[model samples]
Target: MKYGKTLVNDVKTTLKVLVLFVPLPIFWALYDQQGSGWTFQATRMDGYIGFYTILPDQMQVINPLLILIFIPLFTYLIYPAFAKCNFLKTPLQRMVCGGLLTAASFGISAGVSFALEATEPSLPTEGNCQIRIYNPLDCNAILTAEPYIKNQDIKTMGYTNLDIPNVYGEKVVDFSITGCDGKINYQTGSNLSVIEKETLFYYMLPDSFVRGQDDIERDENGLPKIRTLVNKRVEDFNLTYSDSEKDVLNLPSNDDSLFSINPGSYKVQSFPKELKFYLGGVYTVLVSLDNNNDVQNVEYYEVTQPNSVHILWLIPQYVVITAGEIMFSITGLEFSYSQAPVTMKSVLTAAFLLTTAIGNLIIVIIESAKIFEKQSEDFLLYAGLMVLDMILFGLMAMKYKYINMEQNSDNEELENKSERKESNAIDNPTFKHNDDDA
Candidate 1:
């Protein structure tokens, strides 16, 4: 009776419990990218941090290091300082503050990518050809681009990806990729201009390399079917939007808007109007106006020109998001226990764990949807969502009245004593084990 009463009667406790889950999935989704997607981003950026050259995967170590620094610093120093200033007196307030910081960090991360996009991909190289294989698995794989390139071994265990260094110095570098199942599938790319090093992008994946032994399976046609990406051309789009929608899109000014359904099938751009693709790449633009609202869909593509940006650019987002994790995740755990009635504490704890699991699942769902292609826009959307969560939670938190745990414990003790007295008077055989009753 007491357990069920406590569970149902505690309106304030229910609200506080809901607060624990409101923004959790969003937080975890972004947090998880630090290990998976963010590491991929690190692959493309220059990894030389001061004097140390950090590997892409090793960049995840910064989160734990930051957590170690945050725990003591926030507990002993920062929280106390904030308390003195009359803010962050409640866990909810601290969580909101942390969420803002997290948003800022993602904003900074997007800024770095934006900066990289602004630069033209230009590099001078004396080498004839280079062969790169993107091996995602831990096992060593051999790569060969026949005729112009051959027998290039790639190891992805410790390194991000392998650029067969020995293949350089040849003048006619052919970009050929012979996959295990078909004809050569490959990319044409300019070496990211470095002072003296090669550049690579973690966000992109190299095709599975073909082995020397697999060459015998080729059909007798001497020519093999080429693998192709499904790039839908912009001309194929059936767009319906007002002038306001066009302005909102803010497409690149260099790309000409003129088009004609021709008698002779001729096409033209105003001087500089070649397709606005990244150097050594082709792209298909996706446009739409069926949104039913004023909101316009905008997309910008970047074919990263190897090592164009600094890796230090990722630090701001990492710092901000880590600070958020300390505030929300760490404090949310403690808050859940504090507010839960003794009989329902375990239930509340399990609910909190459920939020994290669901949060991970959200990332998998979003990726499979394939709707969000740009990382920058995605970061902004996440930041906006978190801010909205903070607003909603802040409102709910304002109405919450904390439970007096010590008082509840005392009442519980009294109830237990009264029950024992009743059992003693009844001379119940199940309750007769204790010798002190004699």
Candidate 2:
């Protein structure tokens, strides 16, 4: 009877240890989703929700809510059934089951990725445009005049005097005479002189010219006579010149002469309306000026869709990470307690909690380091940390040995004391003696 009672006690202790360990793996699996599966799945969801901005990580709230609800439900409803069932009476069994579920989560995510890819359309090409201006010049003209006087001492003959209007529209007495004298002379009526002696004389008018004036009596188009000008002032006339006219006016001869002058304005027409795609599934457009310094083109483009494999592959990664958490975080908790000395059970539980606290501290330290030294690829850095975590946990599992407190002398003594008390009660029959005295 003592042996049977001892066996029962041993079974009860083992069962209690198993029960405590079972929940650890489950909680760890759920917690790991915060970083891996939940984060990975969030990236695939669209942010637009009518008029609100939604951060991708915000989806993680669902995991916490699930944990809050499921933890209690599982403790009350699911844990009892496991306790009654023989199959779930071990930490190893619970860890294995948790790992399988974690894997299943990743499998679901992979399936979702494929479904999303099949439904989504190919990205559209971006469009762009550019403008340009060619060349420019002023379309104005300049004019100048000079006067000449005559010396009559030379033997020269002069023609009759005539009145002519000057550029100022004032009538002036002038003489146009031809003579053998090489020098030409010009005089106003007030300075005119008559001499009886006949001599050869010539008169030359000042080299004065009108600007922007018509040169030919009939223009090249067979028009009527019009005064020709050397350099015309376009601004004075409030006139604007076109690109073709500006080209003709800017010619060396026309630039100073009254032929034509080009003004400094040109309108560009050609602009591109398309662009090419680049990496990261990110689209970009460019707009710039042309060779002629005009607005060249604005380009548009659509980036290629991300490889379907990326999303599909991450799903499995999520599952594996969750599995790792189940193995290390959850199972480790139970392992720590089961391996600890009976007197230090609370300390062992504290150590299990400390692992999580240390993990969080590590993450915080990494993030702070990033603040000091900016990380170019934050996602890669985070992934590397996770990989490190998995490695560390695996190593710990391999090297660690569970405590065998059941064999301790102190525990054996406590068990023997309880057994002796029970035996004394059976041998002395205390209850029977009390009833007989009554």
Candidate 3:
């Protein structure tokens, strides 16, 4: 009971100091994301900006470099100016502000992540061919990926899927490739459309087909014509099948399958409404776009896959996070040193570092679960939690009784004055003469 009473007294006295440590863990979590969250985000981004190519790992350099620059800039230039205004008067106030800023940075990151989702979209794996007909009319031409099949079975997976005849029962279809006219500077992965009664396409190709080379032969339209791609010629109709459905798959009639191709350009752009491309295909998700037949020059938007995100987008996040780090990390270290009792200073420093390890442990646990599927959602959660933590810290900080170092200063002054007096006495001529006589 006596020890318990003493412990209560210690807690009562040091509650303010303990509360300050709360935000430190959250700060570390945000700081560490530069290595994990942000790095992976950059992997999906277009890294090339003009002359330089910044890899995903290289994005981490922004964090440390910003920390180095912001610390001095804030300490010498910004803090003093704020100090004069009496705005950030105490350590607690600064820490709360830092927490808020960290939250804001994550919020900004969340927004950017939403924008990225549009370009690199996911597909719904419902069926074999998931055609998301967002609008059939506007898309007069479909931008299909260049044909190159990687299959070992020549008889099964081949160009035989395109066996549909026209209304006249003749094997002639409205197949035409409109070369990119100078009018539209369509980038690779950009969407174009064509209007026909029905169009059948082969999304898959036989392994025997040549991938690197394009088989070109032009029709009267001056557009590059698609030569009928045949893998293994069907020389023998008498074929053996182990599986019952094998005959239906091996012998192509007039229908669509997972391997059937759609009409579109090799160059494409993904949009909001996306259909699931085949699992192991280059095109993961596809958006079917159509035009509204309004009279005045119909303007269609194209969202293309950028090779790299402009490195400039990283600035706001880096700036806000660094600001938080400067305030939380640097100030916390100084606080742990100055506020701790002289004998317990080492113990306090270790305690401060332990918070960082705890923060990392939290991240490891969260990542291991793979709880949040979308990275954007994960960042949003980080932002929200950070804000809530800041609010709690602020309340604690407001009640904190800042430690007084005046007594320590007074003791140092007394020791310095006594040493000066002793020096003066030793220098006195009378004292020196007496010592000589003795």
Candidate 4:
């Protein structure tokens, strides 16, 4: 069934639609980051708000939540106001504004990233050793190291981090721990090699001390790595997570070991410690004892404090992006349908979706390239790309002739009805004889 009359025109219209769609993928690429890049950014931020805590992944809810609010707000208030101003009169104009807002959202994110980077702890330089001490004793402990740290006071049940000269093979650094009065209690006079560019954590416990290398490996998706430093007293412990159970056995007195676990709230049985773990975090759980040698409490230390930057800073970016989504994505689809030829609606819709998939592919390519060392740089780069894409889209939109498919369909239907009536009168012999008699 070939409709030869409209075939050429439909093909020409479809080609124009494809040209207009060329820049849409970039918009989707930036918009889709609310799930990936934005969520990851939230993971490193503090989620506490008064009495309630918002998880990093839960930040995505803001998009949909705002969408519901924005849809009615735009329909009733915003669009009406814009109409009076003679702005955003067409879908193309709305989509262009949407793309601009998307770029602006990334600009906000980049600003936030710059702020966060300033507060973030600096990584150890090559040929340097970064060490943090966890003193779980009832009294404060003063640590003295030769040739580097003179006297650093690590408070009771608290930790202090320091960077020192790296000790390579065949050499050892002397370390002494004492009370506040400078009375030496523990000393490491033997050979202890410290690696450069690595973080070493020392746990001070009752009757013994343990030291382990910090594992800064991030959790991918929902799998987080948990390193448990069990006090010698607790023989075995069972961890009940949200989905599974992990039983740790026979760890040495005050010894720490690292293992991966599903991210969730964990209940440590046999010692009664309930804790919640977030995504992409490397955690150090310390089970300490009191003066009476009984189980004191459980302590948690994250290698990189994921909750340092506050999550509320993300609100501005989210708001802008959601607004952009309402404008760019929805309006783009609407524009595609309205401009499409009668028989080409389905094909254009599929092409619109294909642009979204291509946008995601762009993300993969950028991520794999490892172009930027800092996340802030990555955000700025995306923003720049979005601006460039919007410029191209705007140029295409200017040249695009808006075709009213509904009006054409209505006229075609009217013509078909008129033709049927004419045929009926011509086929009637009585009407022809009446005309001949008249």
The positional error of residue 364 in candidate 3, measured at the CA in angstroms, is: 2.6
lDDT by residue (tens digit), candidate 4, 1-438: 365546667888899989988889999899999989988887667666666667778889899999999989887898889999999889999999999999999999999988877755566677788777787656688777676567889876577877776545323567777783332244544333366777777776555556677756454443456776544444453332333355533344334666666446665544566666654567777666544545577777776554456789999999999999999988888988988888899999999999989999999999999999999999999999999999999998999888889887787678778877976874556554556677
Two-way lDDT contest, 3 vs 4, winner: 4
- Candidate 1 lDDT, tens digit per residue, 1-438? 556444454545655677657666766766677877677666556555454555567678888999999999999999999899998878878777776777677777777656654543432234322222334333344443344335545443211223333344323333432232222233433322212233322211333222110011111111111111111123333332122112112233222231211011111111122222211121222221222421122222222232446667777778888998899888878888887777667877888878878878987987778767766667666667667767776777787777778787787678778877976885457765657757
Q: Which stretches of candidate 4 lie over 4 Å from their true place?
A: 1-3, 134-160, 166-189, 203-209, 215-255, 258-293, 296-306, 410-438
Name the 10 consecutive residues with the lowest summed lDDT in model 2. 128-137
**Model 4: ten consecutive residues of lowest lDDT:** 235-244
Q: Report the number of clashing residue pairs per model.
A: 4, 52, 29, 0
Worst 10 residues of 3 by lDDT: 214-223
Candidate 2: tens digits of C-alpha lDDT, residues 84-132: 9765455555554554454445445545545544633332122211111
Answer with 2 or 4, whichever has the higher lDDT: 4
Compared with the true structure, what per-residue lDDT tens digits does model 3 show for residues 312-400?
68778888988988887777788777776554567678889988898888788777888798889889888888888889888877777
Residue 429 deviation, candidate 2, in Å? 41
Two-way TM-score contest, 1 vs 4, winner: 4
TM-score of 3: 0.55
Ranking by lDDT: 4, 1, 3, 2
- Residue 60 in candidate 4, Cα distance off native in Å: 1.2
Whole-model lDDT values for every prediction: 0.51, 0.37, 0.50, 0.76
